[model samples]
Target: ILGLLDDSPECRAFKQQLADLSLIYGKRGERGTLVTKTVNPAPLLETLQYYFRQPADFLEKQIHLWETERNERLQSVRKTLQDYPQDVVEKFERHLKMTENANQLRELNNEWLDVPIMNYFRRLVQEFARRLTESKVLEKTIDVYHLTADELQEATAMLPEVMEVRQRVHERQVEEEKFANVTPPAFMGAYPVDAVYTLDPLTLSYLNTEAPNPVDVPGGLGAVPASPGKVIGRAKVLRCTTAIN
Candidate 1:
């Protein structure tokens, strides 16, 4: 079960579990390596209380919808498999079941385990950052991200004069600013860019760097559709957070 982040005795125990779990679980986005943002205690507690008071049936409805969709998909698959050999059909059905189970497990882990653990870790780091800021060990709470876990711990325990740490953070921040303006090449090193698909089949599954089997149109490029329809509008393609802002 997922534990709520709060000051209650049960939540205090959950926080300890998070400290141990933090070594393995973390955000998987661009700032995955950095300490996550803190949850504001007042707002978080208020949100929890509000939800508890309102008792919605959203989960029950969602479960019903999921069951309906799964049944429809399974029926469709079995109908399609009728012409195939018994052994082949059995193998396909088994694979489908395994895939469904794996997907469900992944969802449960992400919602119940990964999110709560990471948020608790975020709360931990942000609390440490606030203390460091108060002691003048760090200029800003966000600067705590520039320090590694070990460095942060040392700073917190030993309370060293962090002029050097400040300098290091400044230099790294400068490098980040420099890279902000630079656009990276799609493919690098000895491998030819055009041959990326041929060289690595897994690249298609992972990276969205290249469009597969692009077709030539009158004035534009035609691409494979991942979804059903097309909506044309003014779209801004942003490479970084600065551009998004």
Candidate 2:
């Protein structure tokens, strides 16, 4: 028989004993030490009972705290992407070069990045092809001027000189355009300038170049220089806003 008692050490000890006895009886026969019987529980009912036993106010407080934390984290990530779209795109392009294949590019183009930007690039390529077709710039031509063996020998002899003149004319035209451009801007002035510069390892290596070995520095191996400049001491690489902290 179980006796009712106040919440004391003796009472707690008695309750523990009762629990141990119940478990023992539930597992084995009344007298046998190793009786085995199986008990099946309904998952939905068990879950409902477990939740119902929890204090409502405590559960509500926990849920509210979890929701607040999740929303704050989502907002932080959104702000980061918004503030660094181009940097994100460049990083993504680098990552793509490593992992992308024909099928992967199709998946990424359909599922990731802004849809409008992808559409614009597709339209641009289509327009370029159309223009080339209209101009007959990359046309496939079947030579209708089939020549005899003697005539072929004669044409071959003249081919080298004709090709040499064409190349010289092309080079002359390029030089003319270079000189015709406006004067170079002063150091302090704001003017449009075209300067050629090397890309960092992240971009250069992605483009399949044998990039220069990175300099050993404090944090890690430094990224290859994007532009050439001399500095006296060590330089810190800051790729993201969070790195400032």
Task: List ranges where model 2 is wrong by over 4 Å.
Answer: 1-10, 18-56, 83-236, 239-243
* lDDT, candidate 2, 55-162, per-residue tens: 979788998999999789857765665545465545655564565452234433322334434444545545543443344431211110222334334434554332
Q: What is model 2's C-alpha RMSD?
A: 28.6
Residue 96 lDDT in model 2? 49
Task: Please report the candidate that would top TM-score against the real structure.
Answer: 1
lDDT of 1 by residue, 71-181 (tens): 999898899777766665666767667656755435445444565567668888999899889888888899888788988888888765543477887888888889999
lDDT value, residue 132 of candidate 1: 89
Q: Each candidate: RMSD to true structure?
A: 13.0, 28.6
Clashing pairs in 1: none
Local distance difference test values of all predictions, in order: 0.65, 0.49
What is candidate 1's TM-score against the reference? 0.44
**How many clashes in each structure?**
0, 0
Model 1: per-residue Cα lDDT at residue 52: 74
